[model samples]
Target: MQLEEPQLKPRDYVVVASMLFGLFFGAGNLIFPLHLGQIAGANWLPATLGFLVTAVVLPLLSVLAISATHAEGVYDIGRPLGKWFALTFMVLIHATIGPLFGTPRTATVAFTTGIAPMLPKQWSSAGLLVFSALFFLAAFLLSYKERKITSAIGKVLNPTFLLLLAVVFFVGFLHPFGAPSSAPVTAHYQQAGLLNGFLQGYNTMDALAGLAFGVTVVTAVRGLGLKRDRTVSAVTAKAGVLATAAIGLVYVLLILLGAMSTNYFTASAEGGTAFNQIITYYFGAAGHALLATMLTVTCLTTAVGLVAAFAQDFHKHFPKVSYTAWLAMMSFASFLTANFGLETIIQWSTPMLMFLYPLAMVLIGLSTTSAWFHRAPVVYGFVVAFTVVPALMDMVAAFPAVISKSAVGLAVTHLRDYLPFATVGLGWLVPALIGLALGLTVYAVQQRQHAGAQEME
Candidate 1:
């Protein structure tokens, strides 16, 4: 009764995978690993491993989980929870990775690292405004047609971006930046290097991006004429592996470059600054030009992906609002917010990310393991409810002054002592596990009871 769509060839798989890599490899991806290497110093090995776990492993798993569910979008992945909960979570993710923080950071990072260094100090602010305006305008135009994102990013932008990075990698690898210094480890990296690295990886926010971008990957796969859910899932899984490999290779090389260059370059407050310093140290003025081009292209690709995803998701929910209108609004908001600069945007985003990351991880875990639970709504509800407790605590901890002097703050502080990993910013781990176990128990009991009732009838 139904026609099966033609399967995509191996080359198509590589193209889609490259597109996914471009989407994930943005400003944060470029900066974070390099910073981790600089700070991790002698502990770079363990730190890099930990960074890979959260930055690469978790994000890849998220894509696989979404594909497993045959989700239409991030909202669909959350549907097992409830309609309202799915809507709320999806909206928060899109907003966080769209106009509020992610999109703006892309433009600001590009300007700060790529363009600002070339300009005079006094011209920085004005330069940013003009650059971000043009940046978002370009992203807006590229993202106008969601259907063509793969071709634009995969076929065009990704190759150029990779070529630029390859230049940096080749030069940095061939010419040693005065061997990696045996520098003193930073506070977090001194003892708990792995944990610190894991936490630092969270700064990339790629896992959240993975959830949001899964729809784009799915669409790309479908476009290649793969229609069956199982076939799509397999293709998505392979593509995720390829993308993960690409990003992982880049991260490792960047981390190594950062570590080696620590002695040559002074410590910078921002990762982008450190990265720019490394490039300049290796290749002089020409390196600056290369870094500028690499960052701009990578950031533009990321911005296009985020804007397209946000517009598509919102337009789906509110059919009356055209995708073009949503894209225009988001691009404008991102442009305005980019003027705030990277540091300020990061500061504002911390509390929100503190709350959202744990919940998103839990959802991803549940979705990945859903086959074991038969997609029970109660399991989703209970797990999320329990996960929220620690997530809220994390939010408060993120902004201690908001409740520091209050009774609630005192109570939360006291409760922290009882929570494992609370001191390391992962206070939610134990609670999430407990929630999963309890939800499973309850689900099992209910299923048994229903079976018994059916036999009695």
Candidate 2:
């Protein structure tokens, strides 16, 4: 039987954007930016802007690139670099954002805001474990199928999530705040306000979700009857722009609210704990509870999406497992990890992302420029080689301070002579640039050889 297709028009981009925003804006979207502003204090304005560039702009562009390229997923998007490279990139991204890190984070955040405060001092940790278990069980149930009912529920709840956040921000702002706190004594970093804020924003992992989101956006566009590749690409780009704009606006508001909170509250608490205090101080305990409920609901939707996305990807790669089986496996894994709590989950995720993100960025760059090299394997090989080594070095360096610090200083010092940009956190940049140069040189050589052979023929 032939199923009817959606003939999506330009106007549907709004709906697409709304859906994308709902998918992208999860737990970190709520509190992390707030903490950034509080940390930046009077420097909040510049810091927030810096955060938006990486946190907001990069993810949106990634979505647009996915659509324009007509890739199956992020791995497909990186196919210009060869199939195996794409597969490795996919594994790393999924591990970071899937069962290992981002999935569990949802339950952790939900528990911190929704259940932790209500617990007595001694039983706090136990309460958190119980809440996360229950939360994932609910998410697992919600994601038991890839059906209309679940999608409809998510669409409905997405708006409520936004509304609750808006309420919290407005209420917090209306109450007068005191002067901003001074910077931490140990705070020594570049773009101090901006760079640190940018890295912190990475916790959102929206860029990782760009791959999952591209699939949904493409499906939605096709459902609207825009099945033509070019049209789908254009529509996805438009929708992504709309979604990013909404996210940037919300981030700005949250950061401002966080900065303002410092006037009335101390900066001593963890961002998560301080967040609850800020809301409760403004609108009372009832408001805090309401916002916490909203956060849990939002995380629930995100968890559902992540589960389904991972299942879809895994089923595609390993059809023998079946989608149902894959979903169950991922859900169980996420459920178990959620017990570790949000703080630990986030702490562990950082080094993984630091190592993997450079590789991901290399793929994104190559994919975006695939047209220039005619999707040649030579370019892919050079770029992958250039990126992988530095990334591995980064992972190795991110370990026990005493051992890695002493060992890495000497290793990096010696390695710097041969490795380009070894000093920058972006050690891959110089190598990637060299790869681009070599790729162009090799392409030129190949083109000349072809011309000579043609003349002989």
Candidate 3:
């Protein structure tokens, strides 16, 4: 009995996998690849590969990192860096993924991108209010009990989402819009399809979602009877593999759908438009049958997951507040933000995402390698210190044009232009590498000093 590590049943794995998939595959996930296929056009294959790197692979690694570190959540992920940093980073992360913005954005994205066009023009504002209220209410209900999250999402919600989406995928591919192989390419894609595709994947901000969602998945694993961190991590990794694999498959289908639509429609300004047009073409007047349901399900699943995660983590840290209270607060905050402040929410969020993604990626990378440096604070401090400046610059660059034109923003923007790969959105790469090397050198020197002291004693 001692030899046995408590294990989850195979069914549990599927349910957990479904839950994780539900959390990660939100509205943005749906739209991005479809748009990628349109722009990549004939270059769809390479573009798909690039998209998979960030959207599929990075998210999976995020789960693995948390598991491997045996860390409770994002807070633990940064704990080696000291309490203040870890707390600050965790707050920023949860805030980004929580009610203030990301959570609400999911609701607004579904309504604005999918449902709004179908409504009478005069109903837009009222429509948003009503829709957002209902959306947040449903999300709050689904996430009401933390223990029930896995089953509520995996058994009930996720399968429904897939079934609804599958109807479109089946009919669209079976009849065919046309091969994307010869689709006319966008000019930039013609010049740099692969690179452009990678950047698009980066822009999806799945890396942030990955970091934020880590707590949810970890908690879910613990709820399922795995007591040891090792056992929990293993199960979590298995579930993550299943989840990301499912996500990757879905992305391919959506991208193909976009690519093939070249025969029937020009690429619209955004994936939401492309998706809407394709549904309209496929199902005609009954288009909302698939469109509204599918988009809503995707966004709702994400909202449930994020809200549940926020409540759990906050309750853990701020024990004075009950979990249920946190849940209610998040839902209410999301409700108000979704209806009245969505545009403002998006403007602020883009800059925040621009700032945090590089830092999150660096942290994820460092955590995955935590054992090598023994989870040293110096290593984390150095890497993050170097990455923060460029990430801040990216944040400034992503600000609204009105703000970006200001003197302070212009100065930062001018300085960023001198950083390599800034235009490609990876100006932090080189600096991070330099930090890693210096940190290792310092670490080695410290190790030698400790060894010599021990030897003399």
lDDT of 2 by residue, 397-422 (tens): 65445534686645854564366545
TM-score of each: 0.96, 0.88, 0.96
lDDT digits (tens) for residues 8-69 of candidate 1? 77899899998999999998999999888888877788899999988999899889888888
Q: What lDDT would each prediction earn against the true structure?
A: 0.87, 0.72, 0.86
Off by over 4 Å in 2: 1-11, 147-150, 176-186, 189-191, 223-226, 400-424
TM-score, model 1 to reference: 0.96
lDDT of 3 by residue, 202-294 (tens): 656677777777777887787887677788888988998999999999999988889888877898877988998899988997896678888
In Å, residue 442's CA in model 3 sits off its true spot by 1.0
Per-residue error (Å), model 2, residue 39: 1.2
Name the better of 1 and 2 by lDDT: 1
Spell out the clash pairs found in candidate 1: none
Please report, as a residue range, the 10-residue window in candidate 1 with the lowest summed lDDT. 396-405
Error of 3 at 219 (Å): 2.1
Q: Candidate 2, overall lDDT?
A: 0.72
